[model samples]
Target: MLGGISIWQLLIVLGIIILIFGTKKLRNVGGDLGGAVKGFKKAMNEDEKGNDKSTDDPQARVSHDDEGTTYDVKAERKAEEQDERK
Candidate 1:
């Protein structure tokens, strides 16, 4: 009656799964899954918060690269400030 399977058929499948896996293994699997979800949510929230803060303050911005060369991100800002002084 549901998804091309009857209620009794569904119950039988469920019973077989429980018999094979047992409740203890199922419980541990559920707990591990829940922990992973929680960790992912926490990481996402922290990243969002960091982005929000950096957008409001230019000095808080950061640039990353794999090479040894270094770049100054605030060079433009310094130029603007110098022009303003003149």
Candidate 2:
């Protein structure tokens, strides 16, 4: 019934996939996928915290380049001053 594929046809395809991969391998793959998603969520949360902190600090200015690289304005100015002195 789904795009011309009946429930029985869907079950057959599912069975074939299970037989090819086995239950254990499928379980491991699922666990790995879940872990990857968890890690991605954690990284996103940390990035948001970092952006918030940067905005809170008056001396810290964040800028993005064409390549999506972030720059800290205060840090860059300090580095430039050191280079000038050298």
Candidate 3:
């Protein structure tokens, strides 16, 4: 029984990989794959620390109003022009 992979099987797998991606390009694939795994793990650690702030935080408040804020310069200018016209 050939418990280990035969030379022909190894060659076939290598040939398929080379045909799909050239050897030189496949060389960098290893480093790129490792970096992706490392980034995922770092993100998981950050998430466990309760600091992924993209979601809402208790300390942050956003105010929305129909009257709008005082920084609405066009509204302020229109009001000033109306007052001057009177």
Q: TM-score of every model? A: 0.55, 0.57, 0.44
For lDDT, the strongest prediction is: 2
Candidate-wise lDDT, in order: 0.88, 0.89, 0.84
lDDT of 1 by residue, 20-74 (tens): 9998999999999999999999999998898878766666566565578767769
Instruction: Indicate which candidate wins on TM-score.
Output: 2
User: Can you write out model 2's per-residue Cα lDDT over 1-86, one digit (the tens) per residue?
Assistant: 67899999999998999999999999999999999999999999998887878767765655444676667999999999999999
Candidate 3 total steric clashes: 0
By TM-score, the better pick of 1 and 2 is 2
Superposed on all Cα atoms, the candidates' RMSDs to the truth, in angstroms, are 13.7, 10.0, 8.5
* Pairs with backbone N, CA or C atoms under 3 Å apart (clashes), candidate 3: none
Minimum summed lDDT over a 10-residue window in model 2 is located at: 57-66
Clashing pairs in 2: none
lDDT (Cα, 0-100) at 84 in candidate 2: 100
